[model samples]
Target: MTGARRDSCDVAVIGAGMAGMATALFAAERGLSCIQVGNPGGILFASGLLDLFGVHPVAERRLWRSPYAAIAALAREQSDHPLARIDASSIRTAFEIFVAALGAAGLRYAPLGDRNRSVLTSIGTIKTTFGVPLSMVAGVDALEARPPCLLVDFRGLREFNARQIAESLGHRWPDLRHRRIEFPGTEAAPELYAAHLARALESRQTRERTIALVKPLLGDALAVGFPAVLGLARASEVHAAFEAGLEMPVFEIPTMPTSVPGLRLLGALETAVSARGVRRRHQASVRALAFDREAGTAALDVEGVPGVERVVARAVVLATGRFTGRGLTADRGQVRESILGIPVLQPASREAWHQRDFLDPSGHAVNRAGLAIDDAWRPLDADGKPVWPRLFAVGSILAHQDWMRSKCGSGLAISTAWAAMEQVARQLRGTGAG
Candidate 1:
């Protein structure tokens, strides 16, 4: 499956993250032969919230428009193309569809609604919400006005800081009872955490032992909150069992750089794409793209494997992500596209790359460094002309937007992928590819 085949697809997408997956799914549903490549499991590094809009007090004053407007514009432009698609009435509606699809696969997203302002984090920060479990009214109601809360950290998870979280919020909610209980699994190597959890789930003794270790901390507590990766994939079952024994409201908080929800999403997407006959090859890094300008085809080289090539369809969707995903490149003083050598929009220097602090709301505004496109989401050359008639760009690859810090990563992927699919479908219809 890695080698070149005489087969043809209506659309071929690169990168398998949210954008790529959504694009492929939309294309396939429209009866297009779609081929998808790359690994999007990097979503695990994201906070599982579907930041459809940045409605939080801290986020509303930004230069961008509401998520609704952004998605509407994408859908409108995409509708001009040939694909069958759905227009989401609002950001919340789009999120509902996303959550529903996830739930059908046994993964659930409990919408907290849009009217809430206070969210309880596992580490104790009162974050605002657009609609995530931590920000739900139920989550807030579970706290019952900042009672004494016990925060637990696996000894080795250095990403979470109990002390910092406590200090940041404790000053405001002085009565917020905070305690850190470190579990023994912290002694294991960082890479071993997931493996250790799998082993624990398979072993009754380990599971019981872990429950026993944390049993003493939950004594008569009003509620309990911990990082999402609490060694539990069936959260409801685990929460039920814990409640049956401890009689406490247990909830999980979203953690960064590989949250549990993000992991679940990747798994769900893999299953969905595979079921639809889409072949997925992981770690099969594409070294170069061979474009037949006359034949209107592209051949991709599978690195480290000789005589292996994938001749994809004439139309390609470059959903490859930003710098971290290797879609964009940065050198001493220049930034450009890595694959296909497309020109990119970049800042003047490293100092202008980001703001000083990671938590600074303004840290991730490198929009100019992304792929430039017209209203149709097609990649534009330096002269602002469409580079390829059939090639479309979506997600983080587009310039002038920061999905992560702006809390719109998932939304951007979904809407832009939808738009790109519509465009491809239209083109295919015009060319009789389908």
Candidate 2:
């Protein structure tokens, strides 16, 4: 490894997904000199929905708590700690601020309430709204307390199975009424759809056209659902305006591989971080970390162009993501810690790794395989001691939780990063590091 004396920042966040970006931003806002180092696109490979909760209706109350409760728990643990320092209220406030910043940067997000019922998508599949199952779409009345509903879809977009969804749910709630409306054009060109709607809205033609199209179908309907793509960030305001003019409750169904809301969030977060002067180094993989306990700092060995370089920082946040992102690894007959060699909490044998089938929705229950961190979010040794005074962990890197199966990836990232930043801030204040 080539040794280089690089400029040291108060915190060096490794990874640039929602978690990493949030940690860096919060750290910088606290007057900490923060540097974000990681691959260019952190979570581009998987779906990007900021799923706060996905507990099935049957397990909701027993398995998981409400969003507010989770945030409160994070706040309680992070307050006065060392890593980045912010509170629960500040966390929510920061999210809103970040949203506004995104809006100003040409991206937007519509806050859907805490209802987790699934809604029918144009493709005919049902997606859980808050945490409700998509299979329950047929029971519309029971799901949303609304009457017969209409499902809308863009003509060009395929892969939706409205027929199957109707068939499955209809068996239980035959009274539910279903209809289809296909928007013009191909699904390939999203910008085209967004632009067409934007111009129509700007010219007042969209409102008129929408009324003409929906008047016959809605004659007297109360609610409707459509593909999440309907609310493209660039045109969300226009879409919302149109929805208001139509006087209908239009809910968006989650789509595949980076749903509409997920895409919007990814774009919004990148824009927000960039505007804050945080230099994001994407596609740069971190290979290892060397810590200097005496200096209360660490140097990250990153692999990319110009060979390897050791980056020094007073603190580091690891948000490399979950299994799909390669943050956690499972090899033949062995499960090893990919980065930092952090001790893992794993099964006794490969046979215990998971159940029989790969597609089993139960997923691998090995939540203990993630990075082991103390209450302060600092990496912990096998002896259960903080490994490095300045090194911190966040997001999927933390062990003791399985975000994918738990349906808490977004919440875990957001809340943990918020807590990590709060702790970092306390550390800075107490030690005068920054």
Q: Looking at model 1, which ten-residue stretch has the lowest summed lDDT? A: 77-86
- Per-residue lDDT of candidate 1, residues 87-114 (tens digit): 5543355456556556555556665354
Write down the lDDT of every candidate, Cα atoms only: 0.61, 0.59
- Highest-lDDT candidate: 1
lDDT of 2 at 27: 77
Identify the runs in model 1 with alpha carbons over 4 angstroms from their true place. 1-7, 55-94, 112-123, 126-148, 154-167, 171-195, 198-216, 232-236, 290-296, 304-307, 347-367
Against the true structure, candidate 1 has what lDDT?
0.61
TM-score of each: 0.77, 0.75
Write candidate 2's Cα lDDT for 1-434 as tens digits: 65643556778888887678778777766778777876534455333334554442212322333544543453354332221233446546555554455566665444534434444544444443232212123333334464666655444445444455556667654544555554532335543343243244444464456545655776555655555544444445655654676676655455554444445556666777777777655657778888787877788877775566677877887777656556777777655566876776677787887767766655664653677677788877789887777678887767655565555665566667878887888887777786
